[model samples]
Target: MSAPTGKALEEVRAKAQADVRALRKRVDHLDNDAIDLILRQARSHYAWTDKPVTDEIIHELYEITAGGPTSMNTCPARFVFVRSQEGKERLAKSLKPANVPKVMGAPVSVIIAHDLNFWTELPFLFPHEDRRPHFEGKAEHAEVTAFRNGTLQGGYFMIAARALGLDVGPISGFSNEIADAEFFAGTSLKSNFLCNIGYADETALFQKLPRFAFDQVCSFA
Candidate 1:
């Protein structure tokens, strides 16, 4: 199928918004299948099948991910979809032994990174007011906000991928220094974590692990 042109893209987006509104009119919450697709039944996959993650799906994933709200809409997250053999090799050099195979075997390995200079785009992202002054000269504050919000976007990214039928394997057991040097050289982007994205080899999966119950993890403030 042909990729949509500029106008076609706008039409597609409009149709999507309309569809959401129609669905909302029917029901306030998603069906169980959607809950399963987005979160409930999704698992962190370490082994992958041969199917490749196409560029179109990656683009759609980001479109959904970017829609998620952030503080002042800072939108600091930057993703590098490491797919080529050479790219995976470069990334593998930064990985621990166990994570190396996971990256190499997956069709796409994502470097979920953040831009320290993200505030420069506040004029475009948060144009309601001049928010740039709050972050411009404050290096420490900017870095903290970038990291916090960028991590939030990264979580949205993974959930979006899951919603789009891709398994995600998020891991932090890697060398940030090497990744920043290899993939983000001379850039403000700093590595947060890595994720293996692809169709999973379900046979290789371990039994589902237990999660903490609400009583164990939450309390009224």
Candidate 2:
């Protein structure tokens, strides 16, 4: 990778700025090399190399992902890092047989969960007023919204990991009820998804899948 010249940097920035303007939005102008690498190939990675993912990278991923928006700033998303062999073992028991080997071999496994009672903390997280009152009588509503948005945050977590030079293999082919029992016992948090993180094995990549074009999947109306 060559260093970007000042003129080249300015040209890319100006083009991005114009694109955002045409799209009627203002995006953060952070110049991140990992972001460039991630945008080049954002697909899910299956096989992984022996290279390990560091704790520092995971911390940075969370720091960046938390900047994404959440409803009422509720930020109900919670992440459980499964790094040790034992920790991975516990989660592996809940995995479908097909996923067991993939997850166990990864450098890190993440349990992305949503707190069913996250609104309880709204008084502090959204402290302008007693925002808890707004969520009090709407228990079911809170759960639904939290699950939806928390799932979105999990997606952001994957992208952030990819943006920080890690590849992700996110999976939902597990027993959620069993996962909750094993990992989050006695907690209001419910497991939404699990993802494996590590350096990708390029040789293991499948042929790139096709995607629908804009007109095939969207409407101007």
The per-model lDDT (C-alpha) reads 0.91, 0.85
| Global lDDT of model 2 | 0.85
At residue 156, what lDDT does model 1 achieve? 98
Candidate 2: misplaced stretches above 4 Å? 1-36
Q: Write the per-residue lDDT of candidate 1 for residues 55-159, one digit (tens) a residue.
A: 899999999999999999999999999999999999999999988888888999999999999999887887557788899789999999999999999999989
TM-score of each: 0.88, 0.82
Candidate number achieving the greatest lDDT relative to the actual structure: 1
Worst 10 residues of 2 by lDDT: 26-35
| lDDT (tens digit, per residue) of candidate 2 on 93-124 | 89999999888888888999999899998866
